[model samples]
Target: MDEVLARQAFDTALDEHRPEFGTFFLARLLGLKISYPDETCVIEFPVRDFLFNPQGSLHGGVIATVMDISMGHLLRHAYGGAGATLEMKLQYLSALKTGSATCIAKFLRRGRSIAFLESRLNDANGNLSAVATSTWKCSPSADPTDGKRVP
Candidate 1:
């Protein structure tokens, strides 16, 4: 992939395709910060008290959200289209607590109508706490302005 093209795609994803993302309730809840100009999309969030479970560990749902966003954003930025999750599977290997967490997402393959993606969440200590794999159904036709995300 060309650097210029990747940068342009990243800008489009952040600025043009889903401008409403800034106001998305979940986004604000997680305080997601995005960084991607390459094949992988990286999302980070500071673990807040409200996100903790009774065990004082990060909730699985929150971790899953990060994984989903990471892969979804990767699909959008890499292919210039939005994708819907058809199926998802997650595996939790450890509990995450303290500091921050980051999710690294990448596409394994993209076919005509389906895409396979995976993500890994690393705790503040850089230990892998969870992993997720998903299949997204890509649209056959996309809006010229917003790509494949259907409203």
Candidate 2:
């Protein structure tokens, strides 16, 4: 994909469709920023009470969700339009406290139909909080004028 188009897509998604709940609750709650440079994708989220676990630490599920969203967002920016996750695996490495966190995801492979990505979440102090890998399947081509995918 062209670098300029990819960046434009990323910016558009953040401005228009980011802070997406259900899929990106933590990213919305924390005001995450997604960026792409070359093959790498980076997502940063601020820490807050809504994302805390019972013990007052950042929730593991929230961390995983951010990582997953980052991966999916990367694929969407790279491919254009939408893509669905086919599979994902998450590994939690450490506890995260209330602060800023950043998740970096990279494209491992990409095919016509599927894309593979790896993501890692880091706490404000730069400690590894979680790691995840995801596969996304692209949707079929959309009609040019209406911008809706044909069935």
Candidate 3:
């Protein structure tokens, strides 16, 4: 598929699946906007009390989750079907204290059965907060049970 169509399908699926964690949850709960700009997926989460850590900074797990989601979304967009993460590693570089943060994910490589991706999270001041890389196992487009594409 072309980039535009692929992005449309990916975003549509995201809305349908409503992935329960990370920016998906934050977007739904706080009305944050998620978009694909160029090769990267951008997510903006408004800093709120619910997302704060005990030390008054955003949780590292939260930053990791957003980056993971962004990576997964990019994989789906590029590969055109369901993909499950086989492994992931995240590195926290700095603390995310307040304001909004953005995640930029890029496709490193893709095969028929696997895809590798990397992403970085930056705070409002454009400082890098974390970086992550993930590998996903790409499943066939056809459903195993019904032999139809998953809708």
TM for every model, in the order presented, reads 0.77, 0.73, 0.73
Least well predicted 10-residue stretch by lDDT in candidate 3: 142-151
Query: What overall lDDT goes with each candidate model?
Result: 0.76, 0.71, 0.69
List of clashing residue pairs for candidate 2: none
lDDT of 2 at 114: 68
Q: Which segments of model 1 are wrong by more than 4 Å? A: 1-19, 142-151
Better of 1 and 3 by lDDT: 1
lDDT at position 19, candidate 1: 43
Ranking by lDDT: 1, 2, 3
**Model 2 C-alpha lDDT per residue in residues 20-115, reported as the tens digit of each score:** 432344354446787888767788877765557888888787787778778877777766657788899988888886679999988877666767
Clashing pairs in 1: none
Candidate number achieving the greatest TM-score relative to the actual structure? 1
Q: Model 3, 1-151: lDDT tens per residue?
A: 1356435544654675465433454445543456778866677765554556788777777777677778877666655566898999999898877678888888776666766788988888999888999988876772222432322
Q: What lDDT tens digits, residue by residue, belong to model 1 across residues 38-140?
A: 6788888887656778888888888888898888888777656777999999999999877898899987776767788999999888999999999998766
User: Which lDDT value does model 2 have at 103?
Assistant: 91
- Which TM-score value belongs to model 3? 0.73
Query: Per-residue error at 68 for model 2, in Å?
Result: 1.3
**How many clashing residue pairs appear in each of the predictions shown?**
0, 0, 0
